[model samples]
Target chain A: AQRVTQPEKLLSVFKGAPVELKCNYSYSGSPELFWYVQYSRQRLQLLLRHISRESIKGFTADLNKGETSFHLKKPFAQEEDSAMYYCAPTPPTNAGKSTFGDGTTLTVKP
Target chain B: SAVISQKPSRDICQRGTSLTIQCQVDSQVTMMFWYRQQPGQSLTLIATANQGSEATYESGFVIDKFPISRPNLTFSTLTVSNMSPEDSSIYLCSGQTGFETQYFGPGTRLLVL
Candidate 1:
């Protein structure tokens, strides 16, 4: 069975402060990890994927195979960063079958 | 990324009634999937709609409860049959655009009264 776990349901941070949203996954085979963000009144979108090795909207995440964790982080949180973040890991053997974590709602206070 | 749209963005229906949600994608995709998000629960895969074939449902989900159809690569439909209050949830359809990138639709909000 494939599973994705987001430990925090709600995370509040002040603008200019650092933020980290934790995510863990369990899969038998190689896992494809991704971070998806849904801004207020906006559609769910891809924030970043570990395979790309890139940053999106100043947020970055490292896939730690040892820990089986893919935590999203940002140095300076912005007010616009407030949104619902979801962590999904796709079982490569399956046909794009993604296991999604219960999303974390981030609140950036100004 | 692929641009996807879902019809009946939201609907309130009576118990025992059924509603069919439509999903359309701008580009032809290799795979299309349906998901359900219950109140305060994680998004779960309902089934995978295969083109020109019957949908493959996940564990705990059955085709009699949720029938899915995909005649082609760009369009599909998911019907919630004999819905109850427990069936009220956000139904989302997503398509895989690249090797591992899946794009989602806006979602259909269903409220079973």
Candidate 2:
């Protein structure tokens, strides 16, 4: 079975500090990983995808196939960065479905 | 990027009632999906809304309980039947033009009493 694990359910950080949200996955086939964020009073939106090999809103995640990990990181946290983040991985089910992690609620304190 | 919209952004209903959520995409899309997020839980895919055909439901979900319709490339609907306290959740709709990424709609929040 395909599974994504986000160890932290809640993370707090002071503004201007670096932040990292760890994510691990278990899948036999080649995996596609992505990060989705949901801000307060807003719908879920894709922050970035490893396949894109790019950064968005200063957030970047590299797919470490050897370790089966895709961790989202940002250099400087801002108050606007506070949101619920999910590590989503596409399963090999050929169903166009993605399995999302439990999600980490990030709170950036000013 | 595709923009998606959902109708009746939030609704509160009594037990034994039903609610049909609508989804529309700004551009044509090849795939549409329905998901449910219960309080304090992760997003769970309820089914894949297939155009011009019946929906494909995931395990633990059934057509009898959550009927779905996708009449065209840019539109779909999900009906949550026999509502109960357990059915109170945020229902989300998503669409993708290609296989790479999916754009999500503003979810419909349902509260069953």
Cα lDDT tens digits for candidate 2, A1-110: 88899999999999999999999999868867889999988889999988788999999997888999999999999999999999998743345578799999999999
- Return the top candidate by lDDT: 1
Among these predictions, the greatest TM-score belongs to 1
**Global lDDT of each candidate:** 0.91, 0.90
Worst 10-residue lDDT window, candidate 2 chain A: A90-99
Q: How does chain A of every candidate compare to the true chain A by TM-score?
A: 0.96, 0.95
lDDT tens digits, residue span A8-83, model 1: 9999999999999999998888888999998877777889989889999999999989999999999999999999
Q: What lDDT tens digits, residue by residue, belong to model 2 across residues B12-110? A: 999998899999999988788999987556899999999899999999999999999999999999999999989989999998656557789989999
B1-113 in candidate 1: lDDT tens per residue? 68999999999999999999999999988789999976455678899999999999999999999999999999999999999999989999999865778899999999999
Question: Residue B53, candidate 1: how far off, in angstroms?
Answer: 1.1
**Number of the predicted model whose DockQ against the real structure is largest:** 1
Tell me how far the alpha carbon of residue B5 in candidate 2 is from the true structure, in angstroms, after superposition.
Answer: 0.8
Q: Can you tell me which runs of candidate 2 are displaced by over 4 Å?
A: A91-95
DockQ of 2: 0.50
In model 2, residue pairs whose N, Cα or C atoms come closer than 3 Å (at least 3 residues apart or on different chains), thus clashing, are none
CAPRI quality level assigned to candidate 1 from its DockQ score: medium
